[model samples]
Target: MDDGTRLGQADHAAGPRPPGVIFTMRYPSDVGFVWKTIALHRDLIARAFGGEARCILAYPQLSPTSAYQPRWSTAIQADFYDYSAENRQRLERVITDEAIRLVVFMSAQPADVDLGFLRGLGLRTVTSENNSYDHSLRQPFMKRLAKALIRRVLKRQVFDLHIANSQAQYDFLRGFAQLPASRLRAVRNGVDTDHFQPGERTGACSTLGLDPDRLWIMAASQARPEKRLERVLEVIRAVKDARPALPIGFFFVGEGENLAEWRQIALGLPDAETYRFFGRQNDLRPYYQAASVFIHGAFRESFGLVIAEAMASGLPVVATHAHGPAEIIAEGETGRLVGRDDWEGLGKAVIEYLDDAELRRTHGLAGRARCVALFSITRQAQEFADLLRPFLKDGAGAPY
Candidate 1:
């Protein structure tokens, strides 16, 4: 890792003193919620600072077709996962060259990469703890224990501030991780309301080759076990079984380890032709716009960003009562929430919305309203800017 030139460098040297803030994350081929959230935040943080701060994306590597390809300001490619002294020296040079005053780990510092090294350089370090402990508990015992221990050590040792993406995540850090209240802050995820807002469904449906007459229910996320997409498939099966004549389709957008198996299972279900898996879509607006309802069946979600996007798209939601969804959906108002594993309840909720077009419209409008008011990208940017303000100021200091 050499002191490589920054990609898409902005002309910050000519204007008001703008503190450089680097957001570091793993830039893999598959675009997930974390990447999207960080990218959106980076752009918004730049705008919110009004020339008082410059935001940069620092990632190890990225796939050629990655949706997160940097479009503005500097994007530094470095070995963020490596903590060797040689790598640390290179990272330090990159930071010094960029004049970065603050560094935010998109999730936490990688297991091998220690934040203490960065903090020792007199740089403000913060960790946006995105994963939930409850979700980790679902993992195998040894893996769970290892993750818990690593996070505990990192949170207690080097990170200056810990930002939780949701109330649920905040609680987990407080109660489970046992971090002090002052060190933890809750900042819920936000969606780009302008991009995801309601639109005419016909064009999107036509482009996707979906029948305009059929009611489309969409789900988008990395297909993982905890996502419980199989449960959503069961709901779709039950609905199709009960109303054989009704034209309804289930369209999933995203690819993951379980996607192939899930797709196979979907093909085996009755009305298989109507269930489509569109893998790793670069643009999800079409799917959200084309659909009449959005369904999320994740067992535990720190924050369901897709749910907010769907709400912003004016689609009524039917999601499991996971901590994230429970906070986002106003029960029987914006959307319906069934128990995490309540297959029957999930089906019933979907059916109720499908059967009543007016009800769907009402909930959809309300959902969009809620998102615009609470979960807009601007609101999230403002919260983040406020948090980073102290660090950006001259002579500002951190607790660690």
Candidate 2:
């Protein structure tokens, strides 16, 4: 009620039936990798567990800065209640009333609910990937110290199970949190293979009003500092200069604080007209479909969801060998992994694919195969369900 959300409607609709799992997170808004994963999770859980599964999502509020409006999928049963300290009583009451068996704190961000609160309620608890510790190492000491405290709390008291999205993240959680191997699980993120699969380029290029003749290299991400948009711009510039005769175009799709800054940088480049920026697109499939290749230069990511999406779209990728991308891209097979901040290396990698159409086709097909086998939403959700299954019945997987 504090956030102007109604819990009564969801409760009334489900009647007295228990929701097998309750997922609590910081935000519920659209247009983030986390929310996208949650959408897939909800769909998969319902399919996997059927009537026996009633998953309820709880979040504090919508993303204030997001360009897209908040919209929830019809399939997910959600409550938009405020989880501030002041609204703790309401949160507790709703969890109790819904008969939640498992309480999953989606991130390590301070929640409206706390571990002690859940433990006091005798609820089985989980804390999923908070952030990339590998990425944090590059931050200022104060920021890194703050993350350390959060990691300590998560390791010592908060969760019965800690799920990391990558092996690098798992190592960080295991060592930093001092969590036992039994208490932690590494689960990679997934993409909707069907929706993201490859399509004919001509139609997509026409829909977006782009020339199909030029070789299109696309990057879709918010213009955040950690995303290294500056590095991406530099790579494209270097590649263009090195191969002046090559007809190439780069499209950037997404919005953020650094968009104008990046746009300005792109404009001053040699072939400024070739760079197109689409601010905050709802459907990224067209961008992916029309691209000859996808490139990402983020310094770090817990899981490279965009890279996976690009691969699912059957586009070969050139990404930094950061925490997430290093694991996702099968170097020399699906895509190439350049060192972080290595703009020249990244440029060369992109050029290699652009110069050879046969190599691009082979790698794109390989990337698609890899995504179908390892990163499908259905497979991801089923893995999540397996982790959650033992706890729903009894105290088997409950906290110690």
Q: Single out the weakest 10-residue window by summed lDDT for candidate 1.
A: 1-10
Tens digits of lDDT, candidate 1, 235-336:
899998887888999999988899998999998997799999888776788889899999999888888888998999999999988899898999999999
lDDT by residue for model 2 (1-400), tens = 3343334455456455744576664554555543555555655655676656567555555444432332321222234234467566666666676567887666663343466666777777876774755544444667656655655554444467778877888987666555657668988788888989899998999899999998999998767888888788888888888888989999998888999999999899877999999987666888899999999998877787889999999999999878888888999999999888788889999999999999999999999999999888888777777887777775554533
Q: What are the TM-scores, per candidate, against the unseen true structure?
A: 0.89, 0.85
The reply for model 2, stretches above 4 Å from the true place, is 1-16, 32-34, 62-85, 109-113, 135-155, 394-400
TM-score for predicted model 2 compared with the true structure = 0.85
lDDT of 2 at 40: 56
Q: Please give the lDDT score for candidate 2.
A: 0.75
Q: How many clashes (backbone N, Cα, C below 3 Å) per candidate?
A: 0, 1
